[model samples]
Target: MAEIPANSLRFHVQRLPGHGAGPAVVFLHGLVVDNLSSFYCTLAVPVARAGHEAVLYDLRGHGRTERPRTGYDPGTAVRDLAALLAALRLDGHPVHLIGNSYGGTLALHAALARPDLVAGLVLIEPPLGGDWVANMIDTLSVAALGLEDGTLHSELTTLRRRKAARLAATADALLNRTSLIDDIAASRPFTPEDYGRLETPVLAVFGEHSELLPGARELARHAPHATVRILPGLGHDVLQGGTEALRHAVLERLGAVAAV
Candidate 1:
């Protein structure tokens, strides 16, 4: 684990260096309360072992990355990613992106903004509509209130949960004290025209019961070269519950790209 200066902020980055040949694969995790640890533990090592350089980074205001009071919008997130990749000397190469949840939305935005820099995409249960932001804000607001009133702390302590309590505190600070919710609400959702214009290959994975299934279907309709996979008995947390399936889908996509 190391910190790299990108977009004038320090970003915690982890790299699993592979043989100098295969395409570089970068993992982008979900929104607040999430970090690079999930991908680092589940997919990064496997991808590196598969002969591809795997890179994982904590998004700004998440994990060990610097948390500024502002700049949590999708546009800023995209810029941060561009700067990070450039700082890592990955600007000249086409990289594969694997994004989970909100991270997937950022990946799509990045690919649309700069097609030459992205070779392919693997989006896991990506929420597309603008309503998601509103929903998230409401949910986080409730959680923050619970944390503030001691209800959440009491429950966690009663259950002997240390990590959960710590995470809850962190989430509360990020949601209630920062501009995260506002930034997300202010973000521009991609129009159908945007999706229709993408020529990059996309592999979209959705849980069978996920609310974002419509987004996956819409993506397939717009992106001509997209492949959609729905995992059975799963929901929004496909990255956690469907790890093996996600890994296989990612490897297969990478292999197909390499063969091309």
Candidate 2:
């Protein structure tokens, strides 16, 4: 992971240059539970192997990046992304954006805000409704505020107390950044009106068994250039088990988009 200074903050970014002359693909990880390393370990290798550059980064306060109390919101995140890409000299390049969950949301907002910077987008299960928005925020707030009766507290306590095992605890602590979650929950939902304006080609991948699949399908339906790829026997972590298959699927979609 390489730490780059941008937008008055520091972020940990992972970049893998591809063998070919294709445009680079930038990856964005899911919520507090996932980071750039997770994507690097799971997906970036395949992208790199496919002769495409892959870049992954940890959001503010998530991984090795410096965490700030404020400016974790979406607008700030979008600006931060623009600044980071500019710092990396990817601002005007036709770069592919791969966002998982919250990261996906960030990608959408970024693409909307900076269309010329995005060549294509791959969104993996972004929350689609107000209910999810509220619940996620509530959960994160409960944790950040250190509420004993909240889910975050209970989960963190379990993780720390060894009742949840050390690996699980590490995962929780690594993935669950209270500030990020709260920021999302406090944010608004993506209305249908939002999709009609998106010009980028989007590949929406969702787990067949994931609760968010229906929303993902709805999003694909609305996006004129969107398509859905469902991974059977998988939930939120669809890319976890059938990694090779997922990588092939992603490469295929990216290739198809490049052809068009």
Give the candidate number with the greatest lDDT.
1
- Give TM-scores for every candidate, taking all chains together and pairing residue i with residue i: 0.94, 0.85
Residue lDDT tens for model 1, 129-167: 647667777876776676666678568878989888777
Which lDDT value does model 1 have at 117? 83
lDDT by residue for model 2 (151-250), tens: 5546756667653443344334533533555566567777777877889988877888888876786677677777888888888776676577678778
- lDDT of the candidates, in the order given: 0.87, 0.76
